[model samples]
Target: MSEELGMVIGRGFDTWKRNIGIAFPFVLDMLFSGIFFLLVAGVVALVIGIDVFLSFTEGAGAVFGSMEAGENPQIVEIFGLVELIRPYIGLLLVAFFIVVVGWIIIR
Candidate 1:
C-alpha cells in the first residue's frame, strides 16, 4: 500500500510539472499584456482628460466635449478630434468591433 501511494504521489507531481510547463508561457504573456494594457489605458485617459479640459477653455459646449466620447477640444478649427486621427475612424471602428467580439466570446 505504501508503494502504491508513492507511485500516486509521483504521478501527481509529474502531472503538476507538465501543467506548469504548459501554463508558464501563457502566464508570462498575460502578465506582460496586462501591464501594457494598463499603461496604454492610463496614457489614453490622461490625454483625453487634457484634451477635454482644453476644449472647455476654448468655449466648447460641456455636453458636446464630454469624456463619454473621448472628445478633444483643442482642435476647434479642425473639429473635436485630432486631425491626424480623423482618417483612421474606420480603424477605430474595427478595433471597437474586435473588442466587443472578444468580450462576447470571453463572457
Candidate 2:
C-alpha cells in the first residue's frame, strides 16, 4: 500500500510537469451562477417586502385554486413559468422547516 501510494504521488508530479493547464470553466460558471442567483433572489425577496412564508402561501393558494379549476393561474405562471415548481417549493420549505426544528432541538 505504501509503495502504491508513492507511485501514485510520483505519477501526479510527472503529470503536473507535462500539462499544467486544465479546463476550469465549470468552476467559474458555478461561481457566477451562485452570485447571480443570490443577487436576483435578494432583490426579489426585498421588493416583495415580506417573509418567504407570506409570498409562498399567497402564490400557493392562487396556484392551487387555479389548478383545481382547470384554468391557467397567473400566480403559477408569473413565478414558476411551470406548474411543477409549486410542489418542489413546498417540499423544500418542509425540509427547511425540519432542519430548523432539528437545530432548535440540538441547541
Candidate 3:
C-alpha cells in the first residue's frame, strides 16, 4: 500500500509538472483574488470609519489586556470584524466560487 501510494504521489507530481502552463493562470487568479479581497476590505473599513473598525481591534486588545491582568481572556472579540462583514460573506463566497469554477472550465 505504501509503495502504491508513493507511485500515485509521484505520478501526481509529474502531471502537475507537465501542466505548468494551465497551473500558472490559476496561481495568478489566486494571487489577484487575495489582493482584491484586501483592497475591498480596506475600502470597506475606511467607509465604515476608522473608529468603528478600531472598536473591534480595541475589543481584541481588551481580551489581551485581561490575560495580562491574570484573568481569563475572552476570545470572542477577535471575531468582531468578521461579524461586521457577515452580510457580505455570502456574496464574496459566491463570487469566489464562480471565479474558481470559471477558471477550471476555461482551463
Measured against the true structure, the TM-scores of the candidates, in listed sequence, are 0.41, 0.29, 0.36
- For model 3, residues 37-87, the per-residue Cα lDDT tens digits are 999989976875775566667666766665687764455444544565665
> Higher-TM-score candidate among 1 and 3?
1
Instruction: Report residue 33 deviation for candidate 1 (angstroms).
Output: 0.6
lDDT of each: 0.71, 0.71, 0.75
Kindly list the per-residue Cα lDDT of model 1 for residues 3-104, writing each as its tens digit: 688899999988878899788899899999999999999998799778656655553444455634676534453554454355457767987999999999
**CA shift of 49, model 1, Å:** 1.0
Whole-model alpha-carbon lDDT for candidate 2: 0.71
User: What does candidate 2's lDDT look like per residue over 1-107, in tens digits?
Assistant: 35788889999888866664553566578899999999998997686455556656676777677678876666555654354355457767987999999999999
Ranking by TM-score: 1, 3, 2
Give the deviation of candidate 3 from the true structure as CA RMSD. 10.5
Overall local distance difference test of candidate 1: 0.71
Q: Which pairs clash inside model 3?
A: none
| Native RMSD of candidate 1 (Å) | 10.8
User: lDDT of model 1 at residue 34?
Assistant: 100
